[model samples]
Target: MQKFPFDAIGFDLDGTLLDTFRDLGAAVNHALVLGGFAEVSVETSKDLIGGGAKIMLARAVDAQGGLPADEFKQLYKAMLTYYSAHNAIHTVPYPGVREALVDLANKGVRMAVVTNKFEGFARDVLSQLDLIGAFETVIGGDSMGKGEDGQFLAKPHPAPVIAAREATGNGHMAFIGDSTYDVRAARGAGVPVVAAAYGYCDMPPHELGADVVIDSFPELIPALEAIGSAS
Candidate 1:
């Protein structure tokens, strides 16, 4: 097993801790049909996710012949509502996620979730999966408040990573995720990342540039221990 160096760990929710594309794709397709757009396939929708809601809506709209900006905005709003209502309807934690989280928590390692999902939806998903209590903090794409200023800084940006650090009061951190966007975000945050080869990815894991890649969630234990030892 590969090992990493850090004191705390941050995770991307969707493809990292759970496989939530089914519910997200379903809601997106429903919204598209309601918006007078052609329905998209679940597989295609998977490609559209990981960037956040606005980007996902934009891609869905573009797939069905780009709608007028106002129409797109309206559709996006509706989509958000529908998605929030249906967020975890079909979501499930990835294999070994529960065990990995349990083990990490027992070890007294700080953990947080930094996802591009909406705060409400993300919380609902975690609750449904019975994993809400495992994390110290959960920051979604829409978690922007007074200090955050409502900016959507999805993966590939360090804002969410930094936010997680601020929330946990931990400077030495690592990110665990499954996409190039996650890798970029970790890099921008000046943190190392562990890529999950089993999660949803449109491209090869090698292209993501993660500091380490693991095939199973259990493999992260050694890495976490290495981090703890290094710290």
Candidate 2:
């Protein structure tokens, strides 16, 4: 068997490791109703994902003629509250995720989660799904604290990804995710990344700019190996 190249692997949470749009959509709808905006379909919530929970709600609100900043803040808070309480209602690991994680673990590869979601929420969801034990670390958007812009140094910034690598104590790290944020972050961190095409990608899988793309979790190992060989 060809050995996987990276010593540590980092994964994105929402849309990558877990199918969370249903719960996310419900939370968004809860806020929208509170804000007096028409509810969007649960399936439509997938399109609103990519950035994080705040961005998800913001997009949904913006689509409905947007609330004032202060009002939007209130609505966002409400959404977070609802989500925090119900984040794992319909969230689940994509097929083969458990098997792949086991395979990676058996190979002695370190694992971590570097997600744009807030730390508490990510931990909560993973814990509820019984997947939290698979990773050595979980770096959320808030994990790196806010930058000068008062925004999280999350995905696309490389900070959280770098933090994940440092936490894993491995220099040879590969990241896997399903969005531009993940791709850009990995690029910024100077690490190879693989795209999870079956997840809720913000763009077409081919356009994600990943070193390799896998249609499902079962393909992850081979995709990582391919990227390693190319490097």
Candidate 3:
């Protein structure tokens, strides 16, 4: 039951706030078929997703007989386009997530979404779900533009978390997410993190560098209250 002083909370979109793997897996397998590769199991696709679009597509291609660089590049582009259009087809907010978020907002806790998903697609999904209004800021994988030398820094980098903090006008913040990448990003940003064990996680929650592991979104209230009391 670790506690911290924080007035804002940042969330990961896909696996953290929403269960979007069904449409994501469908798009991936559809792209694989169009690219002349065998379809992958949804379970395997789930394991490949939290990283990002390119990483997920690359892993899928590698699983179905690796493709040449040029072919992979084309396929990856197609996959992104296809996924963007189909992102919210069957996606749904994770259990208790909507209620929890609304409750937190009502309590005046600033919230934002920081995701490795593309900015446009992330926004689209949130908009379709009517959740766009819930976040004060939404930072996607491509939002900050390429780095100093044209390199992109996605999750596992502090940029997104720092950007979220800046966007929400909060110096004291906590990150809530589902995977190791989220943990790493929060750590790099020097913020405490809460891991959602109910979401998609490639590894055990305890090993993901979270200060607390919450089994349900509703647990968040108690956790935040404890932190407030401690502070």
Clashes of each: 0, 0, 0
Please, what are the lDDT tens digits per residue for candidate 3 over residues 131-169?
A: 999999999999877888775678888899999999888
The whole-model lDDT of each prediction reads 0.80, 0.92, 0.85
lDDT of 1 by residue, 1-231 (tens): 443345578999887899888888888888798888888889767788767778887888886679888988888888888887888778889888899888777656688998888778888889987899988889887675424655566667788888898777766788899887888888998887888887876478767787677887888877655645655
How do all the candidates rank in terms of TM-score, highest first?
A: 2, 3, 1
> Which wins on TM-score, candidate 1 or candidate 3?
3
Measured against the true structure, the TM-scores of the candidates, in listed sequence, are 0.88, 0.98, 0.93
- Taking all chains together, the TM-score of candidate 3 against the true structure is 0.93
Deviation of model 3 at 166, angstroms? 0.9
Winner on TM-score between 2 and 3 is 2
The candidate maximizing lDDT is: 2
Model 1 CA lDDT for position 96: 86
Give the lDDT ranking, best first: 2, 3, 1
Query: Which portions of model 3 miss their true places by more than 4 Å?
Result: 1-5, 227-231
Alpha carbon deviation, residue 181, candidate 1 (Å): 2.2
